[model samples]
Target: MRIQLTFVLLFVAAVLQAQDIKISTKDNDLKLAALPYYSYGKGLGITSADSLFQLNIRFRMQNRIGFIKNEGEDDAYDGQIRRLRLRFDGYVGNPHFLYVLQLSFAPGDVGEIHDGENINIIRDAAVIYRPNRNWSFTFGQTKLPGNRQRVNSSGALQLTDRSINNAKFNIDRDFGLQAYYLNEKKDQFSYNLKAAVTTGEGRNWTKSPDNGVALTGKIELFPLGSFTKDGSNFEGDLAREKTPKLLFSGAYHQNNNARRTQGQLGDDLYQQKTLRSFFADAMFKYNGWAAMATYMSRASHNPVAVDPLDPTLTNYAYVGHGMDYQLSYTFPTNYEIIGRFSTQKANKDIKAFTPDTNEYTLGVTKYLWEHAFKLQAEFTYDRLSFNDGSTKNNWYVRFQIEIGI
Candidate 1:
């Protein structure tokens, strides 16, 4: 296994040690609470009397119904739970140390079935160690610092779902070590740097294939200082900033000897190939308006892989480029209208397997309680162009509702 049996044990002092004990443990000072406290969107929270240990419980569900129409095919419709997740975050011992655990309960949220099997429901199991105000380190499984769209939480998006560009090139999540540093100053130049080393396999990686691993680096700079209300992580200009705010970012990632068609994901490749990706994106918000753009490109020295033992067996690494742009405006009534355009091109080497595509989507959302509880509806026009100069088109219509504590 990639972890090589490297195990970390966290002995949390639960709030059940009120039996003649001053504290559960030296590092912890939590006790049973008579009642849990509630917040608008923060869910249920509790803090120890001594304020050493704390916890928050939150969960959300996305119920959706959709219909699709193809140019020359019969119409199809389906309804199901899109996402169901439970999240817990709190400080354990040291205030600088934090723990986060998230689990996926929706069938689709778990993972795509590979060989009739899915991964563990666990989505995030990580700990953050912030030694100082400017630095933090993370260990365990979590989302990677890839494109801003990929790094952003799904619950924070204005769109019914992420753009097609993210589905194609996002590195997603893995088990690894990540380091982050930030130098921020309001009304001044602010920047952040991120780096990670991960086993180039999914969290369920069984064997550590030779030297297979993924390396990533990212940097973001805010020329005019940070956006109010942590605008960078959520879509749209909910904060309605009076002054303009801008952010620019770039990232690079490399997966050596990857065993999947899409590096860290997709059908298990019987062969391996080193894959590289380049990314650049920017965000801007001003006067109740917001816009964001992203670009990604992927390449491999040997896009095609062939088994040494079986000459006829082969696999091809997904290689191509994708780009998307999003714009939205929030009204004083807590309503928002959003539009997006995205395109993807598969390298000629693998064009037959994938296609060059274009997409346009328009959506409207009503914030019942910010992102925690909302109603959304969208329509999409999709076009697929093949290497043979042939094209196909489809249309999608959907509605969704999200609610949580």
Candidate 2:
């Protein structure tokens, strides 16, 4: 009953805004300008307005099936829920505060018996006080302005998983307060700086009485085309000027953790210590090609050391590196072929924190029926190096079909 009432209220509010809404009825009444509501799960919805001071909602359902084969083990097949999301995003009032309440259902055995019922908040639900074009202050769940790749959604990532270095450098999404300023220059260059105070931990947990602070910054070189002047969008008046036909970006980050701990080889629990990390990333893009690389390292003040006499003490600093490359060529009709490669390595110290595995993948994609349907195939290989001096190899092939309207 409560859910139904909420839907009713939403519908009424949408109707009330219809009088002021300007829809492109003559353009194509049957054609939708955009899908206001989206979900990865099993359903979708729409909004009457899409601009600022508007209302939007989205929902989605998804499923995934995976298989693995090794030398001694038979084929391993498992199917599970990928995502089940319901979200409401919009703005309200004179201050123009934005808010979103998202509920997600995913299969996990974290605190539950099997894949039990799990619902929680996800993503930035904040109000942006963008008083001007080059500055903004946001308060709520948001990503710390770190690397462009880290700020982008996981769905848009080129790799199947985030780099271990990225994970170590920045806490994914955090509940915090932040302020940022960004400006694009008429000479085809841009820069941004942001600082935030967060719980240090991820979004899953609540605020600790004593939280940590993280600072991040990014600089971009858009040599291909000018993006904006000092305070306004750059015009194409200088198209005749010769410019580098490529784009480049780089970022840096640092986080201070006052209360951090890790486990040992024969650990009964993770010990607490002072932790700190630093990261750097760079990206380059030409007409039809792109490449990215990143490195991160974390050190502790009181490094944990194993007891030589007991052979139970364990201690080691953590470090990692990741690199990725992609090349694609799109025709006038939007048909294209893409190739990608990525690699990540971690320092081998302890069994769990050590670098003992790596993965490689190759994929091809084709679009048909005006891009409403897509077909793709991917092949992946994983190599594992055990601490006990053993090696294992596994591979898999995947085929997928996707349709969108």
**Worst-scoring 10-residue span by lDDT in model 1:** 29-38
Top-lDDT structure, candidate number: 1
List, residue by residue over 270-329, the lDDT tens digit for candidate 2.
333444544455544333233455554555554455555576766553434555444444
- TM-score for each of the candidates: 0.88, 0.66
Q: What is residue 216's positional error in candidate 2, in angstroms?
A: 3.6
User: What's the count of clashing pairs in each model shown?
Assistant: 0, 14
For model 1, how does the per-residue alpha-carbon lDDT over 1-405 read when each residue is reduced to its tens digit?
Answer: 333222111111111221233322322211101001122365788889987888988888999999999989999997989999898877877565777788998987876656645566988888876554555567788877788887877788898889887887888888887766667667788998877788878665665556777888889999999877667778888889888999999999998888888877787677788899998999999988999999998899768878888999877888999999999999999999999999999997888767799999999999988888899999999999977889999999999998887
Q: Report lDDT (CA) for all predictions.
A: 0.78, 0.45
